[model samples]
Target: MLVLAIFVGAGAFIWPQLHGYAVTGAAYGARVACSCRFVGGRALGDCRKDFEPGMDLITLTEDTAARSVTARFPLIARQTATYRDGWGCVLETWRN
Candidate 1:
């Protein structure tokens, strides 16, 4: 029926959104992050790759005046889990 088709279509569109919300909610309880590969000496490129679409990422170095090797990363996961074999590890998030 046409009504059934419309219902299915609506469900399809909401499915991804519902899944994303659940994942992001779960990620909010995260205490640690899995480190990824680094391209340059500085920059959070590794962490960025692990980021989900629609997710906001902010990384800051330990010291602004001093040249350091440490960074603090804050990520907001928007998508759900994505597993890539070659990428090494799997990330639990929603695509931002």
Candidate 2:
């Protein structure tokens, strides 16, 4: 029981760091989070946030399917209308 407790505690302390390492970008900066510059891709699905009067924000879907990266690291972006604005994204399919 003591060994199990120690192992669990160690994992808890190091899990975040491990997760950080799992998330990596390729030669181009295109990770789950849109922190770097990347070209626009296709729209995979419908927009979740539709723009309306007085609505300043809108959500659009794009294809971030990369064939060289991990499927788990697929990227998504949320952009605003009228201007080429972008927000962070989460990877879905690197090769999907």
Candidate 3:
């Protein structure tokens, strides 16, 4: 059907934008939570309050040994932030 085709085309174009927003939001939440926990000397449980808007739907994971934190935006994207001794939090980029 023409309407179905049109709807599919619109969704194909819009999905990337929506995914990008999710990725950005998750990355931001991860970075802030990482900084708050590692550099700011806060508890991981307490860092939930620092998440960016819309990040409530994301799932966060922290690796203490790796000094990193990751945020997963379900069906959208995942991002990680690493904490260094001198630096606060560094966001990791996707590789080609």
- The candidate that wins on lDDT is 3
- Per-residue accuracy of model 1 over 20-66 as CA lDDT, tens digit each: 66455434312112223322233434445555555444332222232
Root-mean-square deviation of Cα positions for candidate 2 versus the true structure, in angstroms: 13.6
Off by over 4 Å in 1: 30-96
* Cα lDDT computed for each candidate against the true fold: 0.39, 0.33, 0.85
Error of 3 at 69 (Å): 0.4
lDDT of 2 by residue, 13-83 (tens): 99777544333322122332132223233222222122124222222233334321221222422221111
User: What is the TM-score (0 to 1) of candidate 2?
Assistant: 0.31
Q: Order of candidates by lDDT, top first? A: 3, 1, 2
Alpha carbon deviation, residue 62, candidate 3 (Å) = 0.5
- Per-residue CA lDDT of model 3 for 54-95, tens digit only, reads 567888899999989998888888889999878779999852
* lDDT, model 2: 0.33
